[model samples]
Target: MGDKLSLPLKPFRSRGGVKAPHRKHTAECESVVMPPPSEVLICMSQHIGVPCKPVVKPGDEVKVGQIVGDNDAFLSVPMHSSVSGRVKKIETVTMPNGSKVQAVRIESDGQMTPFEGIKPPKIETRDDFIKAVRDSGVVGLGGAGFPVHVKIGVERDKVDTLIINAAECEPYITADNREALENSWGVVSGIKAVMELMEIDRAIIGIENNKPNAIKVLNEVCREANRDMHGNVCVLPLKARYPQGAEKVLIKVCTGRVVPEGKLPADVGCVVMNIASIAFVSSYLKTGMPLVTKRITVDGSAVNRPQNVIVPIGTRIKDIIEFCGGYKCRPEKIIFGGPMMGLALPDDEMPLLKQNNAVLAFSEKEAARLEPSDCIRCGRCAAACPMGLTPPLISGLVAKGDAEGLADNGIMVCMECGCCAFACPANRPIVQNMRMGKSIVRSAKKK
Candidate 1:
């Protein structure tokens, strides 16, 4: 596969994605509102970097947008409450990965008052601009909640391109696309704000071709904005592909650059931000608003309705479902994220944090369980792997507990996109094994 022969090949079927029943009818039809929960658990280590230090002790009353956790570490960002509440306790809880970590527990007062320090700052200098982004505690809402300040404050000379990911590639995950369409002007304004803050002139918005309406709105907004928008903002239409929204894949498809193995996109003179993140930037810069709320797709097959919701962060999943007219059938499982990559929650009590983009409830029939069968040794997993690594080999080593072999086979590069798991005819839990393999390899490396 020469670069010339394979580079332009867009053979991927845009709609070949497996359809888990959509249980989102009740929720998606209505505008988003705050789903009141009795308690909210705020995680200190929600961001990728160091855990934030708790700013308030137990018995302290806190308002929404109040920074409950702050750290002096440059890599860490502060955590704010999504509701006005009394500090219940700071204790450890099991995260999605099944590891227990310290979390600040708050019992809601139901007042939902804004925090006193939620006002936005006047953006003047680049330093001031960066500070505003950091103070708001904004992260990538697409999925991975990487800190936003790190990108804004990056070495100016190292970055040459800014990529806005409007590619909501996952099926049923229309949060980003909807945000881009509804807030097109905001998206343009946000990017311009980023350009002013970073002094970078070249920015591109990469949207999947499936989202024609969003693409049109973005272009229209860019044309209307008079900030020398010519040639600076380019909307690249990517061929719709599962996992095409992955940072590296989007970077490759949009900019034709391969982020070198174990290297950040900044190393290749690029920084990628989600459309929602850009919207947040606009909100903070224009309205002086903190990141107190965001839009989410509250959908799945077991609901009476399906709709996107503008939800306050930290709302419990149960309340979200109830607000959507409750379950249509006995929801056997509730998953967060899209059907391809979302994690099945043990219970519906998990708080909707910055990282969660969708709250999916599925009936027993919708939550189809596949029995693991013998591997046919087919290379379909390899062909479907966007990273160009063989998943079967990784799964093999994982089955044999060959952590070293898994590492040698490039297990770390797997993004856990669930493409292999979705493609497997043998019904193997390829993604889970790859995740385990990556973890074991990481543990071994740490030693």
Candidate 2:
């Protein structure tokens, strides 16, 4: 196993990403728990794939960890109640992604009662492991919302590397960093658990150089646990760059493996999981508490306190902001997640989803609309794309409604990290057009 540790530390390079301002205001703030909101709005479609159907009706009593909605689809996972409450209603609500999803509204009884069936799973086989993961209700906590059970259930022989993504590279988000520093044991345990269950011997925890404290803490934990004795559990420091935490980018930086176009990390002998997601695995295996609460960084120019807080899942954005001391100035734009990849919310009424990591409130000055101009053709957008995409060309095709041309140029490969738009001198909405191009391709394929 010690021999497996021989993989050399790869040089950290820019890799076409920009040097955006980190603005990690809450990096030093320890997370504090926020009281449960008076009510919760748990959306059934939090995970990718088919939306769950409500299992409990409007007058039903629910306990924490009780499954409220579920679906039999192979790609879907169940939703659990975050608080002991009575179901108020089940209705359709609009999400930040512009999709209307069925959400279960629960009026809290103020008593956090655990479900009677909440107990640690007895995992003696691979099937048991998968079932436990599904029951835990874990997903990609870094904002992707892909079901974790489906990811780990990939054929074992094809996966040789497990990458723990701790590179919270997005600006204004520090939830993953704080988790790495404070829950080092849980992080290592989670990594080991996956490695053993999947029969993988090599694992890498990738943290950006910006988070020196997290890197140092994780390394120390690995050494104490002797994780390197049985398998390679190395902490690889990444160059501090925007979109550095992207799955494809992180795989390339950590394992020197390039995920081919229209493929997944598993297709290249790797599986990437967020650090916080792995930590939750460690916690759930011990306490049997499902994914019900989340640690989120509440910050931005308009936030009054701007701190990291732990709140129940389905907690409304308005309640969380109020807990953070409300707005210092009237917020002009509210974003869920980091500025680079987060979705802008029309209002603060939306409840926090399983994938949400931060809620950024920008004042009018910070959220000032920038006028777009003709492309300068300066090539900055291409140079700044971490995926090495020519945004100007793809965006032009999208504007002309040339979905076929966009697909020929690999438009679907764009992760829409907003680097191209951020680097454009003319302030063009390159990512927005790229998104439109992708939607066109997807809708055509579906048809």
Looking at candidate 2, the ten consecutive residues that score lowest on lDDT are 1-10
**Error at 84, model 1, angstroms:** 2.3
Q: Tens digit of lDDT per residue, candidate 1, span 48-96?
A: 7888888899999989888889898888788888778899899876777
lDDT of 2: 0.89
Model 2 residue 410 CA deviation (Å) reads 1.5
Every model's TM-score: 0.90, 0.97
Query: What C-alpha lDDT do the candidate models reach, one value each?
Result: 0.77, 0.89
Best by TM-score: 2
Model 2 segments more than 4 A misplaced: 1-5, 11-14, 227-231, 443-447
lDDT at position 216, candidate 2 = 87
lDDT for model 1 comes to: 0.77
